[model samples]
Target: MATFLHRLGRGAFRRRRLTLLLWAVVLGIAGAAAAGSGSGSGDSNVTLPGIEAQKAYDVLDEKFPAANADGASARVVVRAPDGKKLADSGPRAEVRSLLADLKDSSPRVAAVADPFVARTISADGTTGYAQVTYKAKATDLTDADHNRLDDALDDARGHGLTVEASGSALAPAAEAASSEAIGFLLAALILVVTFGSFIAAGLPLLTAVVGVGLTMGAITALTAALDLNSSTSALATMLGIAVGIDYALFIVSRYRSERAAGHEASEAAARANGTAGSAVVFAGLTVVIALVGLAVVNLPILTAMGLAGAGAVVVAVLVAITLVPALLGFAPERVLGRASRKKSGQESRPKTTASKLPAAERWAAFVLRRPWQVLLFSVLGLGVIALPATKLELGLPDDSSKPTSTTERKAYDMLAESFGPGFNGPLMLVVSGGDPAATKTAVAQLDRGVKDLTDVAAVTPATYNPAGDTAMVTVVPKSSPSSEQTKDLVHSIRDRAQGVETATGAQALVSGTTAMNIDVAAKFSAAIVPYLALVVGLAFLVLILVFRSILVPLKAALGFLLSVLASLGVVVAVFQWGWFQDLFGLQTTGPVMSLMPILMVGIVFGLAMDYQVFLVTRIREAYVHGADSRTAITEGFRHSGKVVMAAALIMTGVFGGFIGGADAMIKSLGLGLAAAVIFDAFVVRMTIVPAVLALLGQRAWSLPGWIDRRLPHVDIEGEKLGAIPAPSEPGHRDADFTPTH
Candidate 1:
């Protein structure tokens, strides 16, 4: 495997330019083709299977034969110019004209509902609404469709009228479009800075662009294959830009370092391929493992996330080797050349004083220069940033009223004004009982409790099949599903109804939107720790065997934990505190997504491993070559610091790009990740890690001599797992021990 990797790397070094151009071209063509194909994407149906939902869909189909067939079940509510005029005559006229236009021009609109003319209203008929419903030819409404609907409504409004648009289709589409562009730009900048040379800088971008392009092409072509999830574009945007760029960065950095060490470009490429390139494979694998795990959720949207996320990672890893190497091969040593001119007859010059200086000389000087001040300041700085996390609230919300436009905003207002403040769906709690009388009595009591609560606006009489073990209660709150009130009701209902059915020996389980989120948090308690232990322990075990170090693994894990904690703190402050809207330009009020933290940890941890390997591997190499602990640590930092910082900056920028986008979910993700990277790079990698390692001194790599001798070295990544030695009485030490301060 090592030999094969080396040969492949060398081949890329030999043929870099042609390879890069080909990948770029392939990526571009595929991207353009996909954009063209995805034009009607927002028009698809959600494909949910339920009688009421289906009935609702059928009603829409029956009413608005003018709507899109292949599109989503789209709806538009026409009010008045002031965003408050909700009456039938004004709304009905507008709905008729809109339906007329739909039927005449693009006849795909499956159905449109005239709720204004037909609805049963209050005794005073002054307040009325016209609802126009249409199905997307595809699945959900894209940003383009939303814009069109908004424009049409704007054009149609002649007098005192208001229009509001709502539904699943419109919101996500608009959110995706804005974010995708910002993410792309940020990722590109990061890639360029990491590889100073244009050729090298372009390698990752090239690979990403191509991989994403092809995947998009496949997504477009496969729209015919099955129902592609509505989040396809956003998914490709994330994976293609993030994992794609990341994979290339790892391989490119390795290749350049190898070439600088004096091997022929091809040979340097080969070694890098065997090492960093192989690591990329593992990194991508872990992400795929975690993302694919999302398949257990049973919701198609999550299934979409799994498919797209895993697919993108796979493509990124593959192209990082095949396409990236080919691109790098074009210029060989020049592909990742340092940012300096080759003077008249000089060799490529070093750009920075740090690069020119010997690693040993620099490490010794820094510690001697700043040991006391550095120790005092670094901890204090990280401590301040971590403060806000203490106030975090992990409860999920039920507000699905994301602002799509003036129409959506108005629609949200109308719903609140006319109907009441609450989500589309409320807490669906089920309490089981024995007989019809008992069940009725239990439901009556529960209804009274639900209605009396300050949070609940209304409670429907229980939907009970008395002979069965379940009685369903739908409790409507006075706020959106994501509001604090809804969360409060979730707690109240669960606590109040836990043992409501003693006669049936049955219990009540609250299982609506609010309950799902609360349960998710509960699940995280048991799940996150074990998952962390598994992955973190796995990473440590691998590092231990690879480097023959006990203290090193402990130190790495320690640093990883501190940085991760800090990231968590930021997540709590921004998401739990609802600070994203004011600070980061995200207008969101959703809870921390149930799966986000676990998935984030997996991705962040894997990426952190990249820096750990690159920086630490260099330090170990210096030690193997006979530098003392302080000297090796300094030298390693000096040598690998630039690439690490560059990588972090680029990644951070990419994550930060989503701060101003429309989607709260995307912004939250980007902000959390970006903050984590910045924290990891500056505080953890540069300061905290160095200090800990310095403090540990020679003990960082210590392992018992007996254990080292008895256990044949196991390298899970180096293809060295075949090495086996008989177990002996386990006692071995790899280095002389020194206790940490």
Candidate 2:
């Protein structure tokens, strides 16, 4: 591997122009393909095959087309001023006018039902909502369509009526682009400080942008074929930008270090690519494996997200190894500042004793000074932070979780206040598999059984399809959608469904927005154990190959688990328990997103392994090169800690920017990922890992002879680089390079 990378790196250096041109061509092709493909249709709705909720949902979409068309809907909620009733002549006239304008003003508005006609008016007559169905999804809605609705809403407000809109047709505009920009700005700033040169700092950012752009373009082009959800690209973008910059940073930093060591530009680039680039590839593949492992969950959206993210990591690795060296070739010694630039044999290099070591190395020495104390403290502290994970609850985001200022939240509050909390999340009971008459009979019986349940708010009469082969009964629960009581109500209805099915020889299935969410949560929860096993287990084997030690990989996996658990605990505390909710701009607290844990596990596990591989590979390299275990730890920290810390901070900053986003799911995801980077990079990788490795000493790098013989040798330590002589070496013609102790 090292030999191949060494040759490739040197070739790229000599052929820098061609390498750059090839990347440019790749970028241009990807962009053109993405642009020509046009916008794709993506559904955010969850679809789980074989689940009862999915079966019921599919049946409805197939059999009850009118009720389940491929269009979005909105609830135009209206409320009169205090002491006034919408039913009164003046307010009623305004309400009717608003509804008429919504129906007539925009071609996008397929239909709008009158509140009074649909019986959506509250009993008190102060609040009512007209149901408006649009011909297209929110993403498909044009600006004119939005303007038409906004005009009507403004008119209603002018008439002394409080008006708001909610539902799929009125989906909030995404602010992720702004958040991403913020992340880029912050990343650039961090890079400038780390690299200490404008040209050097911009290189990683450029590579990151190119890599992420290519990944996104590919995702856009593949969206329709893969049936990717609208939000899938967000995950891919976040991971790509972060890892892209990070991978480039690692290689660039290594190249500069080699330049400082008095190697000429070509050899430096080659050696850097052979060494740091090797670790970059190994680290990147672990991330890829963990991300692609999302397939174990059997969720299409998650699978797409994982695959897309993995694609980004792959691009990052390739760019780091190929593009970085090529770009460095363009700059040469200019990549190093005057103080850092070294010519062969210009000066004798001082021995790197403890006192002369950098702060990063000193920190490593301090941690190793009392390995047991550092290990115990880190574990205990992380254990304390992980306590909140025990109380983790999962659910999909609902209107109540939106900001109070959002129209969705306002509509939700008004609806819950006027109609009942249950109105927001009514459960649907689908009865089929019998004669029309028998189906109707079964539906009625099921409705009666459901109404008798403790939390049942109301059960609508059976509504049959045109053929009457299937019937649906809407069962509104007494509690809110995210409440435990509502979940219990769903379970109770499904439980009673068994009896109804047996008695009438019919199939009774429970489904609805609420029920589907419940099922999605359950599915995500059930997949966690297996997903962890697959990701952790696979990553463990890869780490063993990289470090060539059983205990090292085991330690890496365990540390990753700790960081992930601790991050999840923090997410739960802030997003669910509402701890410092205001600080994060959360308006409400509920169950953590159903997909958060598994999503976090995959993402954080991959990222955790990133730090693990980069940090441990360095330690292993030093050990392999004849440094004692303790010296190796310090040497590894001295060479790699600044770059690793910089990478972690960049990732943390990028992810942290997303915490301020409007989307609750994105916010939670950002916090979870950012927290994981902090815990894993700073705490686990920096502190606990060195401590444990110090304790293990020579055993840390041990590989069983039998196993070692069978395993394919991965030359991550760049042993092959020895053939390429350095000027500093005794046999080299220059012979000016000084060796540090």
Candidate that scores best on TM-score: 2
Instruction: Report the alpha-carbon TM-score of model 1 versus the true structure.
Output: 0.75
Q: Which stretches of candidate 2 lie over 4 Å from their true place?
A: 174-177, 342-356, 725-741
Q: Write the per-residue lDDT of candidate 2 for residues 1-741, one digit (tens) a residue.
A: 887887788778777889999999999999988888757557777778867888997888877777678787889999988999988898999998998988975788889999898888888989999989988776687767777788888888998999998877764565745878888999999988888787788999999999999998888888767768866888888999999999999988988878777678788888999988899988999899988999888888888888889999999999999999888887876677555554445552457676887778889989988999999999999999999999999888888888888888899999999989999999988888658877876877886777789888888878889988888888888898888899988888888889878888888899988998889888888889988888888889898888889999999888988998999999989988999998988878988988778988988888888888888888888888899999999889988898899999999999998897776777899999999999999999999999999999999888999999989988999876888776456775531222211
Give the number of the best model, judged by lDDT: 2
Worst 10-residue stretch by lDDT in candidate 2? 732-741
Candidates in order, TM-scores: namely: 0.75, 0.96
For every candidate, C-alpha RMSD to the true structure in Å: 9.3, 3.1
Cα error, residue 25 of model 2, in Å, equals: 0.6
Candidate 1, residues 370-389, lDDT tens digits: the string is 76667667667667777876
Worst 10 residues of 1 by lDDT: 732-741
